[model samples]
Target: MARETHIEAYDGPAGGWGSAKSVGRYVLGEGAPLRTTAALAKQNKVGGFACVSCAWSKPRDPNTFEFCENGAKATAWELTSKAIDASFFARHTLRELEHWSDFALEDQGRLTEPLKYDAASDRYLPIAWEQAFAEIGAELNAIDPKAAVFYASGRASLETSYLYQLFARIYGTNNLPDSSNMCHESTSVALPESIGVPVGTVFLEDFETTDFIFFFGQNVGSNAPRMLHPLQEARKRGVPIITFNPLRERGLERFTNPQAPTEMLTGAETTISTQYCQVKAGGDLAALFGLAKALIALDDAAAESGGPAVLDHGFIAEHTHGFEAFAGACRARGWDAIERGAGLSRAALEQAAETYARSTAAIAVYGMGLTQHRTGVENVQMLANLLLLKGNIGRPGAGICPVRGHSNVQGQRTVGITEKTKLAPLDRLKELYDFEPPREDGMATVDACEGMVAGTVEAFVALGGNFLRAIPETGAMETAWRKLRLSVQIATKLNRSHVVHGRAAYLLPCLGRIEIDRQASGPQAVSVEDSSSHFHGSRALVDPVAATLKSELAIVAGLARATLLPNPKVDWEGWTADYAKVRDAIEATYPKVFPGFNARLDTPGGFPKPIAAREREWTTPTGKANFIFPESLDENPDMPAPNPDALRLITLRSNDQFNTTIYGFDDRFRGVDGTRMVVFMNAADIARLGFADAGTVTMTTAADDALREVAGFRIVAYDIPEGCCAAYYPECNPLIPLWHHAKGSKVPAAKAIPVTLRAAG
Candidate 1:
C-alpha cells in the first residue's frame, strides 16, 4: 500500500506552522488531542517530565511551550487511545505481524498486558506478572550466567539503568550491551584519551557567548530541533556558523521559531549557517587536517611578519602535551591529498580556517556523522586538537559539543550501564549493597551479537529499543537471535523485535516517561542527564496509559528477585517501593558526580556535573590534555577499494524519523513525501551512472566479500558531493556488513559504506 508520492521544494523555515500542523495531526489521529496538549504544556516545565526525543538541555527559566514537533509526536505515540491487549494478539498471529512494516507494527498501538508466546497457535497469550517472572528466572537459572546478555536502551532512566547493571553483575555475568555502543561509544572512548573526559565540555549557556559555531557532520534541525532556538539567537547576535557535512541539511540553513507567534504569523525566518561545506563521506579527517594545515601556515606567516603568533602557544605549553608531533603531522599533510579526500578546494577550507583563526571563542558541535566511522575516535580527537590549538577549551563560551540523540543515553553511562566496568564503582556497589560485583569487562553490542551467532549466548533481555532494527547486518543478527533459548523485551509498544523471538519469549509492558508511576511512597520521579551533562528530574503528569503496565524500576526489581533465588543479599522490593532509595544508592556509587542527588532536584534546573576539561583540571594519566598524532589520513586501511562505478553510501534519518522509529513516510525537509525508500544522489552522478531522476534502482555493496543489496529505491537528484550518495537507514542497513565498523568503538561505519547503483531488476 504505497501512498501518493509528492516532492516539493521546502523553502519555508525549519519550524513554523508546519511543525504545529504535524503535531496537531498526530495528536488528533491518535484520538488524544486534549490529553496530548495538556501533557505537552507540562513538558520541560518545572516538576514536569522531560521530552524523551533528544538530549538537549532544558532552559533554567522555561518557556510556556517548551516541547518540539517530534516531542509532541513521541508524547502522542505513548499516550494514544488505541491499545493492544490479549484480544488484539489473538486477532493477528506472529506470522502475520512479521510481514508488516516497522511503522505498522508500532502504530498498532501500545501494549496493555504481559504476554507469553504460545508456539502452537503462533500468538501471544496473557500471562500473570508472577508467572512471567518465575519462568524467566527458571530459564536464567538453567543456563550458565555467562551465556545471558542484558541489553539496555538509551530511553531507560538513570535509576532503572543503575538497577539493570546491578542486576546483571549480581547474576554472575557482565555481558551488558547498551545503546551507547551503537551511537556515541566512540566519543566515550576517544574523548577521555585526548582531553581526560568522555563527555562534552560545553554548557547550555555557551551558545549565547560563543563568537563562532562549527557544526561538523550534524543535522540539528531534525535531530535536535530545540537547539534551533539557541542557533537562531546566535545568528541574531552576529555569530557565524559553519557547517561541514556530506549533504546540505535544511535545518542548518534556515529556521523559523514555532514558539514565536509573531514570527509564525509573519512567516519570518532566521538564516542560520553563513557557509556550508559538503565534505566527502569518510573524509572528515581530511577536512580537519586541511583546517589545521591552513591554521599552521597562517601562524607561521604571522610569526615571520613580526605579528602576534596565531597559535595559542601559552595554553598549548601550559595545559597540553605532544604539540610538536601533532604540528609536524599537520604540516606533512599535502593540500592535494586533502582536497581530493575532502572533495573541496583548498580555497574553501582556507576560508573556513580563517574564521577559526580570528575567533577567540568557538564551539565545535558534532553528531553521529562524525562518530559513526572506522576513524570515529580519531575524528573526535582531531576536533579536540583543533580546539586546543586556539585555546578554545576551558573558556566560558568555547569547547567541544557532541549533540546526543536519545534523552538519557549519556545519563545511562553515567550510572552503571557500561561494558567496561571500573573497579571504583564496583567497590562502591560491593561496600554499599553487601555483594561482590563482577570485576570482568562485559560484551558490547557488536560483541554480544557475535557471541549469539557463535552459539555462546543463551538468553537475551532488552530494557527497551528495537534491537533487531537498530543493529547493522540484520539478516545474520536475526538468525543468531533465533538461536537463543530465552528472549524478553520491556517495552511500551509492539515492534519488530517482539515478533522475531527466540525459543521462548516474553513481552513485559512498561510505563512510558509521560505516564505517572505511583508507588508505596507516592508519585515517583526519574532523573536524566542531557547532552551537556546537566542532570534534571523528570516526573510524569498523566496517569499510565494501561492499568496493568509496570514501571521499568518495578520490572527490573521483579526480575532481580526472581533470578537471585538462593540467599539473595540485596533488598529488591525496598528499592522499587520508593525511587528515592535508588537515587541514594546512585549518589553513594558516584559521590563526586552525583553528590546530594536527592536534594538537587529542588533546583529550578538541575546542576551541571563537574567536567575536568572545563576547568583545565585534566585527569588524564599525564595530568594534562594530550594532542594525538594520527599516522595517516585513511584511518581504516583494510577497507577495500570500491569499483569505478561505486559511490560512498551514507545512511541518514528522515525528517519524520528518529533513530529507528518511523512517524511518517514523508521527509519534508528533503522535499520527499510518501516514501522512505528513496536515495539522494548528485545529478552528475545520476547522469554518469545512466540513471534518470525518479527512476527506480537497486544499491548493492561493492566490498570484497558478502554481497548485500537493497532493492526498489527511487533516485532523487540533490545537492551532494560527487562519489557520495545518501539513503535512509534500517532500510539500507543490510548493505553495511557486521565486520564493517569503527576499530575500537565497534560503532557501525554507516556513513562510509561502498556501494554501486544499478537499474532496478
Candidate 2:
C-alpha cells in the first residue's frame, strides 16, 4: 500500500487556496464532490465563507459538513471556474509571466482587470478602478507616509482589515506590515506578554473538556486539516495526544474523517498522537525546560508523599504572580542539561510529566512550529508557564492554544493589523477616527524585510499576500521586489507576487470570500476571526466572475478615498459600502475585546472575544505571569561543530505540500511518488555515504563560510532521525540561509540546518 506517488507536473509556491496539490486537482475538478457538499453546508454558518484555509474554529453550523483536507483545498481554490480574463492579458508577457511556474502563476485563474504594471509594454495593462485609485493616490502622495508600507493579508476582511488599518493610520503611517509579520508575530508577541490576552485561552468547547494535548510546532495534518477532527475527538475520548514534532506527521499520525460516513465507508483512519515527541529544531526552549523540570520533580514527589499537590496549589496562590521566580527557573536547570537539550530523556521527560500530572483539563496546542523560533517570544512565555503551572487559564478544558494561519489571521489581529503601538489601539484610533494614530514602531515582517533590504522601503501595499514569494530572501526577495516604488497587490489570483515586477506595479482585482459581494449596501457580510476568539459572518456562496470585481472592502474604500480625503473624518466612503461601518469601527476599537462585535456577528454561533475570563491575568509590563528562563539549551542557534562527516538538515512538509503550495507531486506521507527533488536519507546515512539505496544525491553545506550547494538529490532510505535529514520546503529553500534566522523569530530555522550527503555529481 505504498506505491502511488505520481507527479506529471507541479510548479510550487503561489497564492494559497490550500497551497497546491496539482493546483487542487486543477482547481477542484469533477465538481469536487458537488462543491464540497454545497460548501460543507455553510461551515460556521450565519452566512458561511471563511475556510480559505487554516485558523481553525468553526461551528456556527448551518449544518456542519465539517470541511478538511485543507478545507477541501480551500473550497476548491475559491470555487474555481478559473478565469484570469482580458484574453489572458492579451497573451501573457511580464517576460512571459516570468517563465511561468509558481504553480504556473496561480494556475491562471480569477483576477479580471484593474491591471497596471506597464514598464513600457512589458504587459499587464487594463486600468481604471478610477485609474487604479488615481495611481495609488499618486504613488502614495509622493511617498514618506513613512515610506508607504501597509501589508495585511490574512485573507483581509474584517471589513478589509478594518479599512486597511483605517487607511494606514489616516495617511500618516504605522506601516502595518502583516502576514502576522510572517506568521503569528510570536502569538502577538507572546500572548500579550503572558495573558492580558494576545489571544487563545481556548474555546470550541475546549475540545470537549480536554485531558491533555500539548502539541507544538503544529502540523495538524497538512496545517489545520479541520484540526484533525478535534484531535480525533480528543483521541476518542480517552485523550492524550502529545506530539512535539521534528516531522512525523500524517495529520499527527492518521486521520480519515472525510466527514465520516462509517469513516468514509470504512477507510477508517483516526489515530492522532498518544505521545510523539521529536523536539529538536530550536528545541522548544529545551522542550519547555524539560517540561518545567518534569513538573518540578512531580511537585517534589507530591510534597514528600503527603499525596495531592503536584502544583496548582490553590490556583497558584490566587492566579499566580511569579511562582518564586518560576520555581527558581525550574531549579536552575539541570538533569544532565535537561537530557542533553531536550532530545528527550529524563525518562521521556518523566513520561511527559506523568501526562502533565494526570491532567484535569490540559491543552497547550501550538503552531507556526511554536511561532517561527529563536525562542518565539520565549516560546509564548513557556506556554504561559505550562498553562500557569496547571491552573490552566480560564478553565473549562484548559488553555494556551495558538494554531492560527490565515483565514482572517485572527481577524487581521482583531481589526488593526498591527505593527504594535497600541495604547488601546492608539486610544481606539483617537476615539473612532478623529486621527492621531502613528505612535511608533511599525514594519515587522522582520522589519519589513529589513525595510526592503535597507532602501527605506517605498510603496509596498499588498492587502492580500504572496508578498515577494512569502519572503525569506529568495534571491534577496527577488532583488528587494525589483526595487519597489509602488507595488500594490489586492489580488484574487496570479501570484509570484504578481510576476515580481515592482517599479510601479498594481494588479488590484479583489472580491473572493467565496464570491457574492454585490455592494451598494445590499448582500454583503464579511467578518472572520477564528483560532478561538470566534467572530464569524462570511456569506458569499459564489457568482461574480467579475462585474469589474473589487471588494476587499471596496478596495480599501477606494484606496482610502484616494489616500485620505481633504475632508475625511472616517466615513471612508461610508466604510466602503457599509461593512456595518467596519463593525462600528471595530466596536469603537476593542471594546473589552470587540464586545458585541456587530451584534455578536448576528448570533447563532458567532461572537466570543473576551478572554482569560479570569486566569493568569497578564497583559505584561510586569503585571506578572511571565516565566521563560532561556540562557541556553541550544536547539542549534546555528549548530556548527557537528561535522562527524555532516548530516543535520531538516526542512519538511509534503503530504502533497501546502505552505508554498505544491499540491501535486504526490508525497502521500513520505513513500514519495511523483517528485519534489527527493532526499530523505538515514539508511545509516546511505550506507555510510557510499550511497545506493535508490541512488542520486549531492546535498551540501557544512558551514564554515559555506553558503550552500544542494545540487541534484535522489537518495531515499526513509524513516529519518539518525543524524537526521529530510527536505521539502521552498524546495529546501535553497538550503536555507537568508541570514539563517530564528533569534527572536527571524524564522527560517528551517528545522535545524547543517547538511552534507553526496554521490551524484
Candidate 3:
C-alpha cells in the first residue's frame, strides 16, 4: 500500500505554531504521553541525556526546555508505551513482515530479546543469549577478517565506538566503516588537505560575534532545528545571512523561535537571510568559483585605485601556499561558464562578493548539499579557498562549519571509527594492546556493498543502523545481503535490516540514549563530541524501557568475548564492567586528542579537542594551508553526449524524518503532506515536461547500466532551478548507482543524480 500525496502551499514561517502543534501530536501520540512528558524535561540539559537528533552542541547555559520539536519526537519515539517481544515475532513471519512499511515496523516497538532467523518456517525464533553469541562467534572466527564488514552507526557513544574498533582490529581487520561514510566523508578527507584538520573551526560562541553568515545545501529548519535559534539571534543583531541553496527553504527565509515566548505568543517571525540564492543542483562548485572570481576582481580594482587590500596578502604569504595557482584558475573561469554552471547571473555573484567584502568576519557553513556530489571533496576545498582568501580559518568569528546529522557522529570518528589507515593509530595499538592492528587500507561503504555483491564479503555485522535502507542501490544490496554467511544486527528498535537476513542472522537488543546505562561498578556517562569538536557528557535519567536491554558497550564486549579466544592481552569482561577502561584505552590510543578524557566532562560545556588549523598551525604536507583548484564547474562526472533530458535529482529528507526513520507524514515547512514519494520541480520544468499543474510521473535514472526507475511519484511545483528536481531519500536511493559517489572520498552522490521524468499510466 502506497501513501497518497496531497500537495498544497504552506506560507507559515518556520518554528511557529506549526512546530508546536507537531511536537504536541508526536509526543502525545507515543501511547505514553505522561511518561514521555517527564522524560522530555531532562533532554539536552547538564544532568540529562543529550538529544539524539542533530550534532549541534548544547548551549553552555541551557534553558529549562532546550530540545526542539524533532528532539521531542525522537525521545517520544524511543520511550513509547508499545512493546514488541517474541510473541509479536511469533505472529508475523519474515514474508509477512517484509511487506510492512518502515514506519509500521517501528510502530511495532522495541526489540526485547535475542532472536535467530529460521529459514525452514521463514520466521525469527527466540534464542538463548549464550547460544546466539557462540554461533555468531564461531561463524566470525571461521571466516577471513578482511571478508567481514563491521559497520557502525552514528548513534553509538565514544566508548562504544572506541571498543567496537578495538574489537575489530584485535580480530584482525580494519574494515570499520560508519555512517560518516555516507554523509561527511568528503569533509573528513578534503579538510585535512586544505587546512590540516578534518573537523570544523567555528564554535557556538562564534555564532554570537560573527559579522556575516554564508549557508549552503542544508535545510536548517528540518535537519538542525536548534540552529534556527542562533540564526534568529544573529538576524536580530543585524548580522546579514546569505543563503545559497536550490530551495528557498522556509527556515532560511524566516524563522520564529518556538522557544521565545514573546515571538510564539504574538505570532511574530524574524527574517533569517538578507539574501537567498537558489543555485541549481550540482552547481555549488561553480557558484563558489563565481564568488572567488568576483573577490579577485574586486582586489584588482582596489589595487588600481590604491585602496586597502581586499585579499589578505600578508596572511596569505605567511601561512598559505598555492594561492597563485588557485587565483589563476579562478581568473581563467569565464562568466558565461559560471552563469551556466551556477544558474545565477554574474551581477548576483558580484553583489554577494560585495557583501562578503563588507563583513569583517564571516562563517561559511554548509551541509550534505555540498558533500553528496561527485565533486564533494572539491566542493569542500573550494569553500576553504574562499575562507582562506580573507584569513578566516583561525579568526574569532570566521571559519568553516559542516553541520552533522547524528548526535555523536563526529565523536565516534574522533575516538576511532574509520576505514582509512592514516586516522587509526597502528603503532600505538601494537605497543599498548600487544596486537598487530590491520595495516591495509579498509573498504568504505560502497566497497563493502561491492564486495557483498561480488561474493567477496561473507558476513555483515551492524551496530545500530538500517543498513538496507540507508545505502544506495537498495534492491541490489538486499539481494546481495542473503548471500552472507552471517548477519548480526545490534539495535534497540527493529528496522528493515533485521528482517532482511543472511543464512544465519541474529538480532541483539541494546540500550537507547534516553535510558539509563548502569554497568557492574555503577552508573556511567558516555562522551560525545559536537560538530565544533567540543566533547560533552551524556547521562540518561530515565529508566530502560525493557528489562532485557543491555548497553551498547556491553553488547560489543560480549561479542568480542565470544569471538576471540581467551587472550590475556585484552580484557573484554573488565571493560564491560566499567566504561572508564574504554575511555582510558581511547586516550592511550590517541593521546593528543584525548589527554584528559574523563576529567574534562566537568567543565561547563565540556572541553574542546585540539585542532591544529584552529591555531593557524598547518600540519599539511607543505606545513601550510594550501589552496586547491576544482578541475570542473559542474559536479557531474565526465560524460560524452550528455543526456539532454536529464534533470539533476536531489534526494531530500522530510521535516518529520531523521535519516531513514520517518516520524510522521507531514513535511510542514515544504507544503508536503501524506507522502514521501513526491518530486519537487520548478513550474517551468513542469511545462517543459508537457504537464499541466503536474501529474503522476515515473522517474528513470539517466546514468549507469542499471535500469533504475521509480513509478507513481507525483510532481510538485517548487522554487527550484529549471534543470533541477527533488525527492525524498531512501525512497529514491534505488535510482542512484552504487558506483556513483564523491571522487576522492567515495561518499554517495545522492544530491546530483541525473534522472528523466515521464507521465505515469
Residue-pair clashes per prediction, in order, are 0, 15, 0
lDDT of 3 by residue, 271-375 (tens): 998989999998999999999999999998999999988999988999999999999999999999999999999988999999998888889999999999999
- Would you estimate the TM-scores of all the predictions? 0.99, 0.35, 0.98
Give the per-residue lDDT of model 2 (tens digit) for 587-646.
Answer: 777777676677777566577776753454565676656555556767565556788878
**In candidate 1, what are the lDDT values of residues 595-628, reduced to their tens digit?**
8999997566668899999999888898889897
Model 3 per-residue lDDT at 706: 72
Error of 1 at 32 (Å): 0.5
**After superposition on all CA atoms, what RMSD does each candidate show versus the true structure?**
1.2, 23.2, 1.2
The lDDT of model 3 is 0.88
Pairing residues by index, what is the TM-score of model 1?
Answer: 0.99
lDDT of each candidate versus the true structure: 0.89, 0.72, 0.88
Q: Between which residue pairs do clashes occur in model 3? A: none
